[model samples]
Target: MTAASRQMKLGAFLWATGHHIAAWRHPKAYVTAGIDIDHYIQLARTAEAAKFDMVFCEDAAGLREANVAIASQTSRSIGFEPISLLSALAVQTSRIGLVSTASTSYNEPYGLARTFLSLDHLSGGRAGWNLVTSASPIEAANFGSTGLRPHADRYERAREFAEVVTGLWRGNPDGAPGHDGQSFSVRDPLDLPRSPQGAPVLVQAGASDVGRDLAARTADVVFTAAQTFEEAKAFYDDLKGRLAAYGREPDDIKIMPGVAPVVAETAAQAQEKYEELQELIPDDVGVALLSSYLSIADLWRYPIDGPLPELPPSEGMQSRQALVIEQSRRDNLSIRQLARHFAGARGHWRIVGTAAEIADELQARFEGGAADGFNVMPSFFPGELDAFATLVVPELQRRGLFRKDYEGRTLRDHLGLKRPM
Candidate 1:
């Protein structure tokens, strides 16, 4: 496909609080992201009009960790439950795919498989599952544990967790197969008929070794925390290469890295807005959250206006560390600056500039083959998302880097991924 016809896939990476930490503080962000059905409908309507691919929602089973103080005063928590919300969204959006988060750690495979199948059927094949292993410390406590399984153990269970799920999704000429496995097993056929897209497209969000294994073995789409062109490119190449070891074709899976875009009429204006957003970041919560994300001690100990200390080596979380270090470097960010910056997009690429400039960067990533598209976390919400779907999307379409119309309805169709049998 040529650049215009190539149709880079796009999806919303929604959090109830909106992507920006202070988003709910914006004058226009709907107060009800916690449960506003109409607000979500508006997003879907706007995205579909842009001919974008899908809308996604992430989930957390635990009370949000950042809700401790001022951030709690914000919309840090809100949204109808994922499956229910998406089910509601499905009726409102005819073309945009619906992808909802479900935890492999918390849910049984047969039930999740059945739920997505039902969502697919309900939405006319527009459903997808964003599988998460539920790694956050807050998430562990929700499940009755004071701490989470070690990273290695989580992915280990995830491997078999996925194997059984995928096995159950297999439609023998007879029906859904029962492949008994170590971590999980199933014996009965799913009574629900195969969805129109077969099964809902499977997606995985972890980028650790175990995360990589599950995605390579079972998911049709994989998401990562890559925030720079280099980091994204490396991840793309690694994943494409690993597909062969999984005995899967490189093209069989689609890669989407998260990007946080802050658009303006000029580079300076975008930067100014970026700065203002950071300044608005509430201090105590932002500081505590920053420390929490990095597993560090009181980061505020460093001078607020001075340089960041060097990041230490880390495993099972290289991508996250790289994002933090490089962003602080690129922006020459101070402790205060870094704190607010994270509020905007949580360390994703913060593309700021005119429409053409934003388009240029997005197009470069697409051309470089680092991403099939993106999980766009708009710097703010409603307005920011509206700006993206309205202004930036049209510019991309005019340049032929994005689709003018969706040719397929399901998330699988949007990603050029095949439905599982």
Candidate 2:
């Protein structure tokens, strides 16, 4: 296909019950979806049936909630380890890609390499790694660290960590000796056949400057959160611009922004569905969730009708902090409004509309230089996911904006990504 004729690549961003913070409480949602392997299997099968390029599972090193109080009100703390979950899904599905998020901060490069390589082999070249530097203080405490390593320091380690992991994945062609790096030293040969599509597709989700640079140098698929067309375009331009400096082409990296869609037969129905989930967010839960993402002082002290409080400096999630701040200011949203917004998609974009409307947004973003595609995050599991497949996929296919059927067996082929040499 010609460049203009290239179909958009889609992936399912599989969260516990759904992407919406309150999805677990929705009447139709599977509240126990996190622990239900059958739920994930069905979702995976649905995505594959919809010809989705991949199914992505994000992971956290510790309980993602702010405290036991907030944790009690939500199901964020429950889930399967991504690799184990994806490995199980591998045998049950044949076409959709399986991507799992794991922290480079807590993992050994050799072990991660072996795990993903084995996964790629097992799945017959349908594996990917979503590299992350553990960002939560709770995650730090679990690892016996007093606090998170400074952002810059963590990225430094991650840069070296990624280098070591990729080098290990590359293996020694001569099979003559071991490899050594500042972050990792491995003396054993991989002793495995090259996967059908080479190494697992390297995916990254960081948006900070250091993170972007690391992705430019290494990631084949870059997952991001862009709340608007302009910002998404800016990010697309900046990251693509960095490729030449790394001796890589712009096409080397595919940018897929996360979008949570609340789809229904009409705009009214869509909003009804969206509002139902929003209403499920208890005030305390909303405040706590937004506060965690802002990584500043607690938000409960701020007046609901007043402007957002001036945030304290956070060594936590810097990119998300800036996005939330800009959004609040630009939209003139009060603390209450901001809290609800964050609860919707954290920092990712949300589209509440008919299936055609959702497809229109994706098409505009893709052709408008804002994204190569989207990582579809449904507002509620099974139900919303089913809606998108039954309604939206056909709309895109009819418009020739997406695929109607699988054109290739491996995720790399589906995404038009080349095998790593």
- Leading candidate by TM-score: 2
TM-score of each: 0.92, 0.98
User: Across residues 211-263, which tens digit of lDDT does each residue of candidate 1 receive?
Assistant: 78778888888877776789889888987888888788888888888888888
Per-candidate clash tally: 3, 0
Residue ranges of candidate 1 with Cα displaced over 4 Å? 1-5, 174-176, 296-318, 326-333
- Model 2, range 53-163, lDDT digits (tens) per residue? 999999998998757988888888888999999999999999999999999889988788889988988898899999999888888888889878899988888888888
Candidate 1 similarity to native, TM-score:
0.92
- lDDT at residue 378 of model 1 (Cα atoms): 82
RMSD of 2: 1.2
